[model samples]
Target: MPDHVLITGGGSGIGLAIARALAAQGHPVTITGRRAEVLEAAAAETPGLFPQVMDVTEPESVEAGVAAARAARGPILIHVANAGIAEGRSLRKTTPEFWRSIMATNLDGAYLSIRACLPDMQAEGRGRVIAVASIAGLRGLKGAPAYSASKHGMIGLIRSLSEDHLGSAITFNALCPGYVDTDIVTRNVESISARAGIDADAAMEIMVSANRHGRLIHADEVAAAALWLASDAASSVNGQAIEIAGGQV
Candidate 1:
């Protein structure tokens, strides 16, 4: 049997793509999401993908989901804290509620997921934790201050944990991608169009152009990065923010 991998937000987009890729490589995968139907649908389409209903924003939900996943496939050897929300707003329009919401899902969620899985990882003496961050995390992304802050917080959490576990068997890392072609990007494009009075296609093009290569990224590209981080090749790649952003800095 292969090692068990738990991926939060694995019902769709990059998370689901990573789960499928890992399962194809013989890993027993548990994919979690806030909606049971979404998770079940994803699991139905992908062999070896187990569905778990979880809301990363809620600690109770994360605890229950992790317990269920561990019960199904022993201790989780790979934990991907990939659940997050992305939104963009200027400082004048940003409200405390919106900022908190993004931080709750993107930063606090990753922290809680890591905390929930670390005990078992420590007990086992070996594990991998990957957070799906973004190039926005590396620096301010102009309009998405809240989203960028949350991502920055995630990298901060991962780096701190990596330092704490320096000599231990577990490793932590983050994948920073730019303009990945996911539903989130689509939604963001629509939001931008509405806010900036540009056409939807133009908004999308603007985002794609942000990448140095002038193209949108594939979900599989990010998934491949996750697989690399989880593989034996990345044993020494701890505390790194591996960028997949077509030269976006």
Candidate 2:
């Protein structure tokens, strides 16, 4: 098990679950998010979680966040780039600003995070990077063109890093989950309802039905996969998109 892990967007949802999972294993976890209050609150709930407020989209903020993590808890052995936004807007309806903003937070944010953390990990000669992509990344989502693009780009970034760091102690991989039960899913449900004139529950059902298993995924399930990736058991796993989509190809 890693001694120190840095997780972005760890204030809530899958990231927070990952923080708890790693902390339970006795790994000192540093969780970064844009909201200080949420991060502090989550840290209060989860033992050994150090909170660092950072906007991942900003390179300066990411650099500072990583430095803070290193200062507080040695070199970060595991890095989870889990910060992202899921907005389902059609190509025709999505503006340039919206698309760029999504890419900035999802794709570019992961890149910046990895870039900021590499030097310290390289010095340590070992590192793990787990990017939280989505099943939409594997295939296009009907109404989420921009969101799909950003996730696809995240997978691409992870794959490239894996290739670049081959033979080194560093590994990069991605997790692609469909309809995980989180606040993001709840927000998406509201979006679906408002846009399609359906009830929120029906919108949720639509998402659940998209999964082959016809159910929502728990955040801890995704966190478990991340835990595996961070562990020695998955040393050989790199540059792969581990899917938790029930049955999406």
**lDDT of all the models against the reference?**
0.92, 0.91
Q: How many Å off is the CA of 196 in candidate 1?
A: 0.6
What are the runs in model 1 whose C-alpha is more than 4 Å off?
A: none
Could you tell me the lDDT of residue 55 within candidate 1?
A: 89
True-structure RMSD for candidate 1: 0.8
- In candidate 1, what are the lDDT values of residues 176-222, reduced to their tens digit? 99989899998998899999999989999999999989999999999
Q: What residue pairs are clashing in model 2?
A: none
lDDT of model number 1: 0.92
Query: Deviation in angstroms for 22 in model 1?
Result: 0.4
Q: How do the residues 93-195 of candidate 2 rate in per-residue lDDT, one tens digit apiece?
A: 9999999999999999999988888787799898899999999899879999999999999999999889999999889999999989999898998899999
